[model samples]
Target: MKNLARTARWLLTLAWQADRARLLKAIVLLTLGYLATPGIALALGAFTDNLLDGRLGATFVIGVLIALVLVAELMMGHFAHLYYYEVGELAESRINSELIRYVNGTPGVEHLDNAKFADTVTLVREEIQKARAYIEALLQVVLLGGQLILTTVILASLEPWLLLLPLGALPPVIMGRYAQRSIDRSRDAAVEQNRLARHLLHVATSSSSAKEARILGAEAALKRRHERSWREATAKLWRGQLAGAALRALGQVTFAAAVCATVYLVLLQAVRGLVTVGDVVLVITLAVQVNAQVAAALSVLSTLHAAGHTLRRLDSLKTWPTREPRTPAAVRPVPARLRHGIRLEAVSFSYPGSDRPVLREVDLDLPAGRTVALVGENGAGKSTLVKLLCGLYEPTAGRILVDGVDLREMPPEEWRSAISTLFQDFARLEFTLRENVGVGDLARMGNDDVLTDVLGRAGAEPIVRRVPGGLDGALGHGYTDGAELSGGQWQTLGLARSALRDQPLMLVLDEPAAALDAAAEHATFEQYAGSAGEVGSNGGVTLFVSHRFSTVRMADRIVVLEGGRVAEIGDHAELLASRGLYADLFELQARSYS
Candidate 1:
C-alpha cells in the first residue's frame, strides 16, 4: 500500500502539470458516470412499482425520472472518455520530453554505454505510456469501489440479507493481488529478454551488418536466436496468466452463487408479505451491480500494479549516478585558456567491470603551445587516453591535473567547450548540412560566414557543392531530397563540425582521414595542419592520433605507444635517429607504398 501510494502520488503530480483544467474536469465526469449505474437501477425499480400499483400520475413521474437518468449517464460517459484521453496524451508528451532531456544532458557517457542502463532505458521507453493512464486507472478504482458501497447500502435498506453479496468480493481481491505479483516478476524477466531480442533485431536489420549476415548465411541463425530469447522471456508470464485466469474464473463462480442465494432470500421475503414487489426488484438489481463493481475494482488494482513497475523504472532513471560522483569534493571552474598546459601524472584506466587496465601507468604532458601526435597499434589505448583527456572517462588510478588544478575541478560542459575533437567513429547525423556543422557550437551554428569558413577549412566545401541545395540539403538517403554522402564526404563533414569550435584551447583529431584518397588526405592534413599550427602556436594544444606517417610527421612531437605504455616520445627526426619502435613502424608503413 505504501508503494502504491508513492506511485499514485507521482503520476498525479505529473498529470496535474500536464494539464490542470482537463484533469480536474475528468474527476468530476468520473463521479457523474459512476452515479448513473445506481441511479438507473433505483429509478427502474420505482417505475416498476408505480406501474404495478396502477397509478397513472405516479407512473408518469417515475417514467420521466428513469429517462432523465439514462440520458445523463450516456452524456457523462461520452465526455469523460474524451477528457481522459486528452489528458493522458498530454501527460505522455511531457514525459517524453523529460526522458530525452535526461538521457542527453545527463553528465558522463557511462549511462549511455552500459548495458544495464540501456536495458532500463528500453523498459522505461516501452512502459512509460502505461503511467500516462494513471489518472483514469485511479478514477476507475474509486468509481467502482463507490458503486459497490452504494449498491450494498441500497440493497441493505431493501433487505438486510442482501448485504451478503458484498462479502464475496474478498476472494477476488486476494486473487488479484496474487496475479499482480506474478505479473511483476514476469515483466522483469521479459524486460531483460526484450533488450536481447532488440539487439538481435538491430544486428539483423542494421545496414552495417546486413551485408555481412547475408554473405555468411547467418540470417536464419539470428532469427532463431531472437525467437528463442522471446520464448524464454515470455513463457513464465504466459503460464502465470493462464493460472490467474483459472483462479479468476473460480472466484467469479463463487460470487455468482452468492448473488443467486441473496436474490433467493429476497424473493422469499416478498412471498412472506414482509416486502413489496418493488423491494424485491431493488434488492436483485443492486446485488448484480455489487458483483460487477467488485470485479471492476479488482481489475483497476491489478492495472495499477502493472503500471507501478514502469513508474519505478522511471524513478530509477532520475537517481542513477554517473561515473563520477555527481557532487564534487571541491568544485572549481575551468579557465578560458590554459597557461602551464594539461598534465597526466601516472594515469591508468580500465573499462567498467574489467580487470585488464587499458592504459597502464601512462605519463604525458601537453604543454600549451605544441602540436603532439600519438601513434600506436590497435588496442594500445590511444583512444582511451584521448577519452581521459576529454574527461569522458575517469582514470581507475592516478589523477589528471590542468595547470596544478585537478581535472575533476572543471565542469564537464565548460571543459568540453574548450576543446574540439573528431573521433574515429563519429556520428553521422541525418540533419541538414547547416544543422550538422552547427552542432559543433550551437551558439554559432547560424553564423553563415563561420559555417562557410569551417567547411572550407575541412575540405568539405566541394562535397557541399555536389548537392543541389548546398548547405541546406538534407543528409541521409532514407528521406526525400536527402543525399547519401560518400565515406570521405562524411569524414570531412565531421572535420567541418570539429573545426566549428572557435579558438578552442585544445584540438584532438583521431584518425582524421581514413576514407579520403591519398591526395585528398594529404591536402586536408596540410590544410588542417596549417590551421592547427596557428591555433596551437599560442596557448593552445593540438593532438592527432593516426597510423599515417605522412600526417604524424607534421606534428611537432610524436609519442609511440606499445602495450598501453609510452614506448617512445620524440619528433620525427629524433625518433628515426633512435630507430626504436616508432622508427620500425614508420619504416614498415613507408615500405608499403614503395
Candidate 2:
C-alpha cells in the first residue's frame, strides 16, 4: 500500500509539473461541471412537476432552463477536451525527451544492450501515449466525483428518505476497484509479452541470421514462437475482459435494487399524504439523474483501472535519474599540438560481465609527432586499448596521463575533443556525404572548404566529386537517391571524418585499412605519412591497430601482444632481427600473399 501511494504521488507530481495553465483551466471547468449538474437535475425535476400540474407557463420556463443547461454542458465539454489535449501533449513531450536523454547519457553501455532495457525503452514509448490518456481520465474522475456529490445533495433535499436507496449502490464501486486491479495486472503482462514478441521478430528478420535461418528451415519455428507470445498476451487480456464483464453485471444488479428501493419510498410518502402527485414526479426525476451520475463515475474508475500499467510506466520514466548539469569549465586556449607524451601505466580493462580481461598490465609511451602500431591476433585487446586511450572507456586498473594530468580526472567531454578515433566497425551513418564526415567536429561541420580539404587528404575527393551532389550527396541504401559505398570507400570516408577534427591531439585508427587492396593500402599509407606525422616537427601522435602485417610494417614502432601481455616492442627491422612473435607473424603473412 505504501509503495502504491509513493508511485501515485510521483505520477501526480509529474502531471502537475507538465502544464500549470492547462491544469488551472481544467480545475475551473470541473467546478463548472459540478454546478451544471445540479442545474440539470433541478430543471428535469421542475419539468416533471409542471407536466403533472398541466401548467403551461412553468413548462415554458423549464424549456428555456433545459436549453441553457444543454448549451453550458456543451461548452464545458469542448473546453475540457481542449484543456486536456494541451496538458497531455506537454506531459508526453516532457516525459519522452527526458527518457531519450537519460538513455543516451547513462554510464553503462551494457544497460543499453540488455533485453530488459530494450523492453523498458519500448514500454516507455508506449507509456507516452498512455500518459496522455491518464491525465485526461484523471481530470474526468475529478469532474465525475464533483457532479456525483452535487446530484446527491439535490436529491437528498427533495426527499431525505429516498437517498439511502442510491447510497446502497456503494458496493458496486468496490467491484470497480477489483476490475481495475485485474485490468492493471493484465496490462503489465501484455507489455512484457509484447517485448518478447518484438525480440522474436527481430531475430527472424535480422540480416545476419537470415541465411542461417533459411539453411536450418527455422522460419516456421520462429513464426510459432512469435504466435506463442501473442497468444499469451491475448489470453491475459481475455481473462481481464471476462472479469470486468462479470463485475459490470454485478453493478447493474445493484443499480436495479436501488431503483426498487426508491419506488418503495415514494409510495410510502404518497400513502401518508406527505407528497402530492407532482412532488412524486419530481422525486422520481431526481432519482434517475442520480443513477446516471453514479454510473458515469463508476465507468471513469473502470477506465482508469484499465490504464494503470501505462501510468506506472510513465511514472518510471519521470523518475529516471537525470544527468546533473554542471557549469562549463573556463575555456582556455588549447595548444595546436600535444605539449608532452600520452602515457598508459599498468592499464588493465575488461568489458562488463566478462571474466577474461581484454588488456592486462599494458603500458605504452606515445610521444607527440610519433607513429605507433598495435599488432596482435583477433581479440588481443587492440581495439579496447585504443578506446581507453581515446577516453571512450576508463581503465579498470591504473591510469592514463596526458601531460602528467590524469585523464580520468578531466571532463570526458573535454578530453574527447582532443582526439579523433575510427573504430574497425565504424557506423555507416545515413546522411549526406558532407554531413557524415563533417560530424567529427560539429562546430566545423558546415565549413565547405574544410570538408573538401579533409576528403582530399583521405583520398576520398574523387568519390565525392563523382556523386551528383558532390559533398551533399546522400549515402546509404536506406533512402531514395542514396548511394552505397564499397567497403574500401567507407574506410576512406571514416578517415575523412577523423581528418575533420579541429586540431586533434591524437589520431587512433583500429584496423583502418582492412578492406583496401594491397596497392590501395600502400598508396593510403603513403598519403598517411605526409598528412599524419609532424608537418614540420610538432604534430599529433598517430596510433594504428591492424591484423595485416603489411600495414603494421609502415609504422615507426610496432608493439606485439601475445595473450594480453606485450611479447615484443621495437621497430620493424629490430623485431625481424630478433625473430620474435612480430617476426614470425610478419613472415607468415608475407608468405600467404607471396
Candidate 3:
C-alpha cells in the first residue's frame, strides 16, 4: 500500500507538472460525469414512482431531470479526454528526455557491461512508450475510487444486505494485482530472448548484414535462429497470460454470484410490501452500475500495477552505481600540455562481472613529444589501455599518473577533452560531411576553413570534392539525397574527425586504418607521421595501434604486448637488432609482402 501511494504521488506530480490547469479541469469534468451514474439511477426511480401515482406534472419534471443527468454522463467524459490527452503527450516527452539524460550523462561506461542493467533499461524504455496510457489509467483510478464510494453509500441506503456487493469487488482487485505481476515476471524473463530475436531480425533485413549473410550462405540459419528465439519468448508470455486469465475468470465468477444474490434479496423485499416499485427499480439500477464499476476498477488496477513496476525500474536505473567509490580529494584541472607524459604505475583492469583481468599489472610510460606504436595480437589489451588513457574507465588496481598528478584527480570531461581518438569501429554519423567531421570539435564546427584543413590532414579532401554539395552534402542512405561512401571512405571521414581536435595532449589511433588496403594504410601513416611535428610542438604523445610493420616502423618507439604484458619496448631498429618477439613478428610480416 505504501508503494502504491508513492507511485500514485509520482504519477500525480508528473501530471501536475505537465499542466496543472488542464489536470484540474479534467478532474472536475470527469468527476461530474462519473457521479452522474448515481444521479441517473435516483432520477429514474423518482420518475417511475411519480408516473405510477398519476402525478403528470411531477412525472414530466422528473423525466426532464433524468435526460439532463444522462446527457451529462455521456458528454462530460468525452470533453475531459481532450484536456488530458495533451497532458499525456507533454509528460511523455519530458520523461523520454530525462531517460536519455540519465543514461548518457554518466561519466563511466561500466553499466553498459552489466547484462541485468541492460535488461532493466530495455524494459523501462518499453514501458515509457506507453506513458499516455499510464496517465489515463491514473485518472481512471481516481475517478473510479470516488464513483465506488458514492455507489457503496447508495446501495447501502437501498438495503443493508446490498453492502456485501461492494465487498465482493475485493477479490477481483486482489486477483488482478497478482495477475499483473505474473505478466510482468514473464516479460522480465523474456527480455533477453526478445532482444536476441529482434537483433536477428535486424541482421536478416538490414542492408549492411544482408550482403555478408548472402556471401556466407547463412540466411537460412539466421531465419531458423530468429524463429526459435521468438517462439521461446512468446511461449513464456503465453503461459503467463493463460494463468492470469484463469485467475481473472475465477474472480469475475465470484462477483457475478454476489450480484445475483443482491438482486434477488431486493426483489424479496419488494414482495413483502416493504418498498415501492420505485425503490426496486433504483436497487436494480444501482446494482448494475456497481458491477460495471468493479470491472472498470479491475482493469484500471492492472494498468496501475504494471505502470508502478515500470516506475520502480526507472528509479532503480536512476540510482544504479556507474562509478566506483572514491575518497575525498581535491579536484584538479587537466594539463595544457604533457611534460613528463603519462605513466602507468602497475595498472590493471577487468570488465564488470568478470574474474579474468584483461590487463594485468604492468608498468609503462609514454614520453612527451614522441610517437609510440602498440603492436599486439588479438586480445592483447591494446584497446583497453587506450580506454584507460582516455578516462573512460578507472583502473581496477594501481594508478595512471599524468605528469606528477594522478589521472583520477582531474575532471573526467576535462581530461577527455584534452585527448583525441579514432577507433577501429567508429560511428558512421548520418549527417552532412562538415557536421560529421566538425562534431569532434563542436566549438569550431562552423568554421569552414578548419573543417577543410582537418579533411586535408586526414587525406579526405578527394571525398569532399566527389560529394554533391562538398562539405554541406548529406553523407548517408538515411537521407533522400545523401551520398553513401565505401568502408574506406567512411574510415577516412572518421580520421578527419579525430584530426579536427588541434594538438590534443594525447592522440590515440587504435587501428585507425583497418578498412584501408596495405598501400593506402602505409601512405596514410606517412602523411600523419609527416605532420606529427604539430603534436610534438605541444609536448603531446602520439599513440597508435597497428598490425602493419611498415607503419609501425615509423614510430619513435614500439611496445609489443603479449598475454596482457609488455614483452618488448624499443625503437624499430633496436628491436630488430635484439631479435626478440618484435623481430620475429616483423620478419614474418616482411616476408608476407615478399
Candidate 4:
C-alpha cells in the first residue's frame, strides 16, 4: 500500500504539468465506464434472481438495459485508451527529444566527459521506453482504482457484514507494497552498475588494446572482473524479485481467505430467515464481483510499482533546463586571406575540471597565407591550443580576435563553418568511397567530379584505384568483406575529406600523418606547402601541428610552445641559427634519423 501511495503521488505530480484538459477529459470518460461496471454486474445478478422468481418481464427489461450499458462501456473504454496512449507518447517523445537537443547544443565538449553526465546519458537511453510504459500503466491504475471503489461500494450496500472482507485483506497488500519499495531502489542501482560494467568490458576487449592484453595475459583478469560485477548485479536483482514475489503471494492468500469467509456468512444469514435465498445469491455474486475488481486493482498496482521507478529516472530529465533554438546570427564572410592575421591576446584556459590552466598568457598571430606549425612534445598543451583556434573551446580569461573582432562575440558556428580540421584521431566513417570524401561538403556530397578531384589532391587516389568498386566501394572495419586501409592510407583519406570542403579560409591538420615513410612524409609536407596562398584556384591559411622536424620544416614559420607559452617564433633557418629550443629539437630528430 505504501508503494501504491508513492506511485500515485508520482503519477499525479507528473500529470499535473501536462495538458490538464486532456488528462481531465480522459479521466472523466474512464470514470464513467468504471462506474457502469458494478451496475451492469448487479443488474445481471438481479435479472437472474427475477427469472428464478418467474418474473420474465422484469428480467427481459434488465437484460436490455445491461446490453445498452455494455455498449456504452465498450465505446468509452476504447476512446479513453486511445487518449491515454497518445498523451503518454506525446509526453515521452517531447521530453526525450528536448533532452537530446539540450545535450547536443551544450557549449563545451566537456559535458560528455563528466562521469555523472555520462551516467545520465545511459539512464536516459534506458529509461525512455520505461517512462512511456509507466505513463500507460499509470492510466491503467486510475481506471482500475475507479472500478474497485465503485464495485466495493455496491458490494457493501448489498451485504453490510461483508465490509470487513476487503479491509481484512489490506495488511498483506501493505506488506507487498513495502517489498516493492526495496525492489525498485535495488533495480535502479543494478542498472547503473551494469552500464559501467559493460563499458569496462568494451574497452578491455577493443582491438587497440588486444595485443597488449595478450602479451601481458590480462584477458583472464579482465574476464574475472567482468564476472564479479555481473554476479553482484544479478544477486541484487534476484533478491528483489524473490522478496517481492513472496509478499505478493501472501496478499493473494489473504484475499482468497476473505472470499471463503464471505460465502459462509451469506449462507448463515439466509438460514437465519433474515434474508431470502435469492438475497443470499445476490450477496455471493456481489462478493465474487468485488474480488475480481480488487484483483484487477492489485494487478494495476503491481505494474505501477515497477513503472514508478522508471518514471523517477525520467523525471530527472524534466529538471534539466531546456535549450532554445540557436538563432542564426549575421556573420561576415571570411576575407580572401588572413590579411590582418588571426590573434589570441592574453588568452587563458583550463580543462573542464582541472585547477591548473593549460594555456596561460598566450599570444599568437598568423598573417595572410602563412603556414604556422606548432611544435611540442606530448602533453605540452598542443591539442588544447588547437581546440581553442578551432573554436571548440573558449578561453577562460582572454580574447581571440579575427581582424580585431572578438571571436567570443562573433558567431562561433559561422567561424567553425569557415575552417576545415583533421584531428590526430580522426573518425573513419563506415560508408561508401563517395560519402567518405563528400561529407566534407554536404552540398556537394553526391557530386562525383568533386569527390574525385579532392581524392586526387589529398593523394588518396591510389586507395580509390585499388578498391574493386572504385568510388562506390564500401569501406569500414565492420563489414565482412570490408577492405581496411593502412594507417597511411587512412590518413590520406582523412586529408581528402578535409579538402572536399568548398573553399574554407583556414585549415588545421594536427599530427596529420605520423605513420608514413620518410619520403612519403616529405612529399605530404610539399603538398601542404604548395596548397597555401591561393594554390590551384583554392585558398586557405594552414595551421598544422607535428612532432616530426621533417614535416615542420615545410611551414613558413614555426612556433615552439614551452610551459604554455610561445618560446620562439621564426622561420626554419632563422631558428636554427639562434640555436634555441627549436634548433635543439631539430638536431635531436635529425641525429635520430641519421
Estimate, for each residue in 1-594, the C-alpha lDDT of model 1 and write its tens digit: 887787678778877898888888887887887988987788778877888989879989888888887788888877987887888898888878878876776545656766767777887787777654666787788778777888888888877766777888888877777777877667766777877888899999988788899999999999999999889877867977877777777777888888889989989999999988887777777877787787887888887876677777777777777654546757778876778888888999888767899999998988776778899999999998998899888888988888778888778888888889999888787899999889999999889999999998887878788866878888986556588887788889999999888777788889888887767767766766655446444467788888888778888889998988989989999999998999899899989999
TM-score of 1: 0.90
* lDDT minimum window of 10 residues, candidate 1: 529-538
| TM-score, one value per model | 0.90, 0.77, 0.93, 0.74
Q: Tell me the whole-model lDDT of each prediction, alpha carbons only.
A: 0.81, 0.74, 0.87, 0.75
lDDT of 4 by residue, 1-594 (tens): 564577677665555455556667777888888778777777867888898899999989998998999999999878877776666666676567766765666544655545656666676676666554566667766676666666667667767777687775575557667777767767666876677578658868877676788899888887888888888888888898888778778887888888899889888877888766666666777677667767666666666876565555455544444323345573445455455668889888887668799888888887656688999777778888888888777788788887777765656667777888888988887688877777787888878888888888778878998876988888866764666787788788888888877666678888887767777767767776645576453346788888988878878889899888788899899999999999999999999988
Please count the clashing residue pairs in each candidate, in the order shown: 0, 0, 0, 0
Considering every candidate listed, which one attains the maximal lDDT? 3
Clashing pairs in 2: none
Model 1 misplaced stretches (Cα beyond 4 Å): 55-68, 101-105, 243-254, 323-329, 466-469, 477-481, 535-538, 577-579
* Model 1, global lDDT: 0.81
Worst 10 residues of 2 by lDDT: 322-331
Tens-digit per-residue lDDT, 426-501, candidate 2: 8778799988998999988889999988898888977897666888888876665687788788888998898788
Q: Please report the candidate that would top TM-score against the real structure.
A: 3
lDDT of 4 at 476: 68
How big is the positional error of residue 547 in model 4, measured in Å on the Cα after superposition? 1.9
